[model samples]
Target: MATGLLALLDDIAGIAKVAAASLDDAAGQAARAGGKAVGVVIDDTAVTPRYVTGFSPSREVPIVWKIALGSLRNKLHFLLPGALLLSLFAPWAITPLLMLGGAYLCFEGAEKVAEAIRPHHTEVQASAAPARDPQALEDEKVRSAVKTDFILSAEIMALTLATVAESPFATQVFVLAVVGIGITLFVYGIVALIVKADDAGLALAREPRPASTLLGLRAAPAGAPTGGDRALGPVTQAFGRALVRGMPVLLRGLGILGTAAMIWVGGGIIVHGLESYGLGAIGHTIEHAAEAAGAWLPVLSGAASWLVTAALSGVLGLALGAALIPLAHYVVTPVLRSLKA
Candidate 1:
């Protein structure tokens, strides 16, 4: 009986070791995969803050939390499983699907540019509607945000899966789950912080006391020395005021940058896909240009090459996206609306 019990304990220890190792491997792979999807991640982060815009301060954090939950649901419950199934039975289809997603991103980015250049009357009318229940409006915004997140999350998951395609099936699943959960937490945490920053700044600016007082400053006996004893309060208040003033500009800049990133990433993906499928003319021409630039300025070679490639890709993405805009607005939207009806 003693020997049998010892054998059982030994087996348990072995299984624990294996489980630990698998988790470590999964974590390593998750980080690597997440790195590969950083471009999409930036776009995700950039795109999210806009959803909370014009919302009441009290509603912002809750809205972000709901959207974050939706994003996680999209990734874990939908995209991850779908990605796994695709990798398992139809690996060959992954590239084409990814290219399609890239095209969609390009379309979205270009549409935003066009919208900015020529604001839509329909959107203006929609915004002008008589006041509705705030909660209902909030829910609509959450749904819109989630729908956008689903597309971005799908791209992130597909990129991650492609990065880990050679791993065992179980490892692939584990790695994807880790990346999904980690990214959702990271992205939403940042969003929450960003959305609340103005409120935080307002509080800080309005409160005359130094931040140290909030952390249990010792009471000064007979007014020997207090928060007003130093310049910290005024300085902090000034900083807070600056933050309050700067946040809107910062958010706008982020929105613009995100849209540009979407176009750049989408363009790069399409170009790379073309190169992979034997239509390498564009890529080769870009490479040759980059090399020539490098030879002329050896010190800036790498940076110049990257800049050339990125510039061409952005142009390509913009053109492709512009071409698709009419088709999407006229054909695709009508078809989708008809289907829904």
Candidate 2:
């Protein structure tokens, strides 16, 4: 009886160890897959904050929370299962679907670039439309944001799936769940923080006591103090003011970065897809150029090569996207309208 009990315990211990190793493998795969989808993640983060804009301070966080829940539902309930099914049955279709998504990304990125250069009449009119009821507007914004998030989430999931395509089925599922939940939390957490940063900055600027007091230092006498008795209130206020001032600039920068990432990543995907389809000539030429550029700067060769590849990819993306704009506006839109009619 004693010997049998010990064997049972040993088997349990071995099973536990296996489970632990499996968990670790899933984590590692999740991280690698998440890294591959970083471009979509960035664009998601950048695009989200705008949905909360124009809302009263009280409503901003709630709106973000609602949209976040919708985004989560999109990934876990819809995209995750669909991706698994595709991987299981239609594995060969993955490359073509990914290429289509890449093309969409390029179109979106290029459209944004075009808008920045010259806003269309309809776009201008839409922006100038009179405000509706606050609740209505808020609902509309959340729906719009969630709809946009679905497309971006699909891209993220597709990228992640592509990364783990060769992994075990269990590992693929685990990694997908981890990446989906992890990215949703991370992206929305940043969005929540960004949209409220100005409010935080304002509160900080309005601090009644010197920050030094919080640091366990005595508050200096009224008016600026000299020497070791320096007060930190003004410095704190300045930093707060700077934070408030910088938020707009930061948002603009994020938008620009997101747009560029969309184009570059989309272009890179198409180039790779073409190579996979045996049309490697374009990809090879770009790689050779990158390699030569890297050779010129051996110390920074990796970064140089990556930058060169990305630049050429962006050029290809912009060209393709530009060519597709007219087709989309003139052909696709009219066909869709006619179908609906």
Candidate 3:
């Protein structure tokens, strides 16, 4: 009886250790995935707040909630299964597909840059831009954001899968689930905080604690509006003002950076793919030369790879995107026009 009980205890202890190891793995993967998508996460957060900008106060949070739910759905429902299938049967296709998505990201980013440099008749955005009706606009924004999220999520999952290429199928699934849920929570939670920050600032400005209009403060009520909230308190007020003012600029920057990353990352993928198919000599030559030059400091080899690959990739993507742009404009554009027509 004692022997059987001890065996049972040993099994339980082993299972506990396995569960702990799994959790640790999941946490590590989440951190790595988060680091990988920092650029997209910034872009996502920056792009999202604008969707709630023109809405009424009461509707802002609700719309944010809707978009957050859509983001969750994107990661969990659609992307999860699709990514698993790709991993299983079409793993080889992942990089090319990612490159395609990356190209689209570059286009979107470049378009935004063009918009900024060009004219703006009104603060109003494009014609197909979001609506004002809370419900309608919420639905539209969620749909658009989810579409965007799917691309980013695919990248995240693909990267994670690559990292865990040799793991068991069940481990891959569990890690993916953890990554999806963790990233969704992190991204959307930050988005929520960002969207509500202005309101929070306004409230803090109005309900000035102990330190009132003494050092030149503005007072009202808790959660009340203060037009002078821009320059309310001394230090905190200045910080808030700066943050609020910088939001638009940061968004534009994020857009630009995201596009650039897309091009660089996409170009790298295509270049790597080319090498995989046959043209490996080019990559081999570069890598070998880099390693030789930096042989004294082996640590810098990884940096060398990143620099060589990223630079080559960006150049390649730009040339490719530019080459395709005209054809896209003349042929694809007209076909799209006719289809919509």
The model with the greatest TM-score is 2
Task: Give the higher-lDDT candidate: 1 or 3.
Answer: 1
Q: Write the per-residue lDDT of candidate 1 for residues 216-291, one digit (tens) a residue.
A: 6744335544646456678768878988998888878777877887787788878878887999998888789878
lDDT tens digits, residue span 216-314, model 3: 454444575355542444545555566667656766676677667766665655556567678877567656755664664577867776676666666
Task: For candidate 3, list the clashing residue pairs, or say none.
Answer: none
Q: What do the candidate models score in CA lDDT, each in turn?
A: 0.86, 0.90, 0.67
196, model 3: CA deviation in Å? 2.4
Q: Which rank order by lDDT, best down to worst? A: 2, 1, 3
Minimum summed lDDT over a 10-residue window in model 2 is located at: 224-233
- How do all models score by TM-score? 0.84, 0.89, 0.73
Candidate 2 colliding pairs: none
Q: Rank order by TM-score, top first? A: 2, 1, 3
Regarding lDDT, does 1 or 2 come out ahead?
2
Regions of model 1 farther than 4 Å from truth: 1-29, 121-131, 215-230, 293-301
Report the CA-based lDDT of candidate 2 relative to the real structure: 0.90
Give residue 22's lDDT in candidate 2 (0 to 100).
Answer: 88
The CA lDDT at 54 in model 1 is 88
Model 1 TM-score is 0.84
